[model samples]
Target: MAGTVQNREAFLNQIAERLGRPRITKPVERPNWNFRPQDEVLKSATQDELLEVLKEQCKRIHTTIYTTDNSELSSVLNEVVTNYGGGPIVTWKDERFSHWGLDSLMKQEWPNQDIHVYEWDHTKGEENIAKAEQANVGITISEITLAESGTVVLFSDENKGRTVSFLPATYIALIPKSSIVPRMTQAAQKMREIHQNTGHVASCINFITGPSNSADIELNLVVGVHGPVKATYIVINDL
Candidate 1:
């Protein structure tokens, strides 16, 4: 009942009557593009090359990017979190953190250093929101990283709330090198694949570039005006 469309049939019928034709109820197949320049851009670049593109875009977006292998990932993460004034750190309830070899650091090492950690729990509801708002840093694993625009794509779920990334003073993303794509063209294709293969997709998908930035009516440039004042991404080469 939460998302039920009560008047959709009637509304679509009215539009069909205006057009003197039947409403389109079937999904249409996407057309083939003869010349898609987007797909051609950065298509041949290797993973290291894509990393370079991401590094350059990070400068424009005012984001700090770090590259390391799996063996050094946890160290890099610790360094960035500390640089952002350390915890209380809010993160998604994701197993990838453990799998990527950060279990001890996140669960034990940080806490031993007096850095509080809160893993978003669905059962807590608004309790999680409060924690996120007060958290000094929010960290999450990037579902898809785009090199062209230096964007981190997130698909929110029960264990992953939007606020974990939006409400904190600082944000950090753990990007697996394999997750890096040439650009949004590839990212969109991946999303399409997920929908086709899984029969569903997350309700909310976020494409975050960096810390919030805006220019006011006076034409003065402002940074971190809406969200986290700092954004950093750590790319694990062997993850």
Candidate 2:
């Protein structure tokens, strides 16, 4: 986020010039809204309670959720992969996979059996997307999870390919119990915290809720419209 250049002034000045008005460069204070995202729904809920909220919301979003501890995560992951038809799999180049003992599962165990696991490498550039598109399952760890909306927040970077979540037939998000928050309000605060303390934050943030859902003229809910046909959230109870 720090290295990126946002052309805010130039973009705004062009619009002002077209409208025949002097550019207003100085920032103006905005009025606070009557309602806030953090207002009252389980704002003070404990982590266990928040997990319940997330579970209920996932039902509405039609996303499957699985709870497993660190020791059982590998087996659980294997189960999900098998359930989704034993993939040509892709995952982020995240060290957390090693921390949670999944590195060997993908890099060694799965590939040896011809499951074909691909990790997103920065040098691959756009080729990564091609791999993702052909993959049956794409896995990513949730950066900050919003329980209220059943959304997993992903911050894309060199190690994390954004399209890994978009093009794959199925998307898997590994959400640690510690990363689960009550709502989007807390997720925004977490983003601000990252911006204030670190320079490694990715320029883009994606808030994905369940699988891609669309509707026709009759307003019938059709899951898996344009994006991933299936989305699963594996919530680690103890990370």
Candidate 3:
């Protein structure tokens, strides 16, 4: 017992010595030495230039981008639906969507198509998720569009469920021109501001660059293995 106690104490002392002393009389100060300078092009670029940059960036990452006026949004959506051959649709139940008259537009475009709107009610949560998973297309409004990497920031709340964008075969996002930002830093700052002002934030913040892709098995690039295969972003300028 005495030998075991001595060995345990020695082991603990060895660990403590390896870890270094806990208390210090004078603590060392650390300062950030590397600083990322603000992008001059982003800072000085006009709205139109920014839009063009975002479009090019999205294209590079296999994301399709379409720009249109608010009045033509319905027509563009109609075209998208027609191109996709018209199937089941899953949409966020956000009031902003109603304000955009998307419901009426969708009804006008595909009256007979099955449409599921994600609700805040927990009773229908499973159903909504299932619908989203099986839907042909999932549509939602992008909270922020990061131009640098062509990423859309989605705040998953009651309306914007996590799987709504991932599970569907195709993902369509309505990005208001005003939501486009120069960099992800701006988007993160805006999110922090929203949290600071409202004292609440969404449960998940998803940054989607393009459609799901993986080059793991045999190094053959395969898309949509884990999420939506096609990603489309409709940028509404006049909105």
Candidate 4:
């Protein structure tokens, strides 16, 4: 076994040495495509206007939104489970959600309903994938995301698995409005900063715009092909 490992290492070193001095190609430059957004791009006439935009987006994709105080995220979560159809809610084993009183809230809300809230821990392997697949709705709080495009960025770290956002039938994201940026580039920059500070590159960074949809098979347009059919972004302004 030791001899085989040594041979593999030596082979890898030889390949690295051979490819070390390869020719460097000139970087291609593209045309500057700076297009100005419309006057109403990110600016809203009022809070109602912003809420209307959120509602419209949710309507376009056949989803629902239930807003609540950011401090009472647990209560909002409970309301979601209680008011909506009963289903499993997946979240990371983070302090934010736990400290927000998730367990007590779940108990209060799902007294009769068979609701399940799974806290993901990587030590247990890929069991959350199956749970998420069967769940009616998957709830998660993003690290940082954008509201302009209604996109949620789920970086692979700790208990915040990518499958929780993608595999479920319905995805409910609680994004603090303060974290919302106007552009995708700004979001990417924030992610880069996170990587630099954490010393861990995200294995999977999902930028989800609304729900999963397609118009391929006979051009009829189908939803829920590769991911959730319905997605709701509950932007909390008070967070």
Which candidate gets the maximum TM-score versus the true structure? 1
lDDT of 4 by residue, 64-180 (tens): 666666577666666665555767766666666555455666555554566776767787786877777777777777666554555667767767877888877778887765666
Candidate 2: segments with Cα more than 4 A from true spot = 1-22, 30-37
Q: Could you give candidate 2's per-residue lDDT for residues 127-223 as a string of tens digits?
A: 8989998999999989899888999999998889898898889989999999999888888878888888985467789999999999999999887
Give a tens-digit lDDT track for model 3, residues 1-239: 22434586667667777889543435688786576575443887777877889999987889888998767788898788667656677777778766666767665546655543343344586888888777888888889988888888898876668887888899888898899889977887899999999998887899988889889768998999989899899998853
Instruction: Give the winner by lDDT.
Output: 1
Candidates 1 and 3: which is better by lDDT?
A: 1
Per-residue alpha-carbon lDDT of candidate 1 for residues 63-146, written as tens digits (9 for 90 to 100): 999988878888999999989889999999998888888889998999999999999999999999999999999998899999
Q: What's model 2's TM-score?
A: 0.88
What's the number of clashes in each of the models?
Answer: 0, 0, 0, 0
Error of 4 at 6 (Å): 12
TM-score of 1: 0.94
TM-score to native of every candidate shown: 0.94, 0.88, 0.80, 0.71
As a whole number from 0 to 100, the lDDT of residue 125 in candidate 2 is: 82
lDDT of every predicted structure (CA atoms): 0.93, 0.89, 0.79, 0.67
* Model 2 pairs whose backbones collide: none
Ranking by lDDT: 1, 2, 3, 4
| Weakest 10 consecutive residues of candidate 4 by summed lDDT | 36-45
Ranking by TM-score: 1, 2, 3, 4
Residue 223 error for model 1, in Å? 1.0
Note each model's CA RMSD in angstroms: 1.7, 2.8, 7.7, 5.8
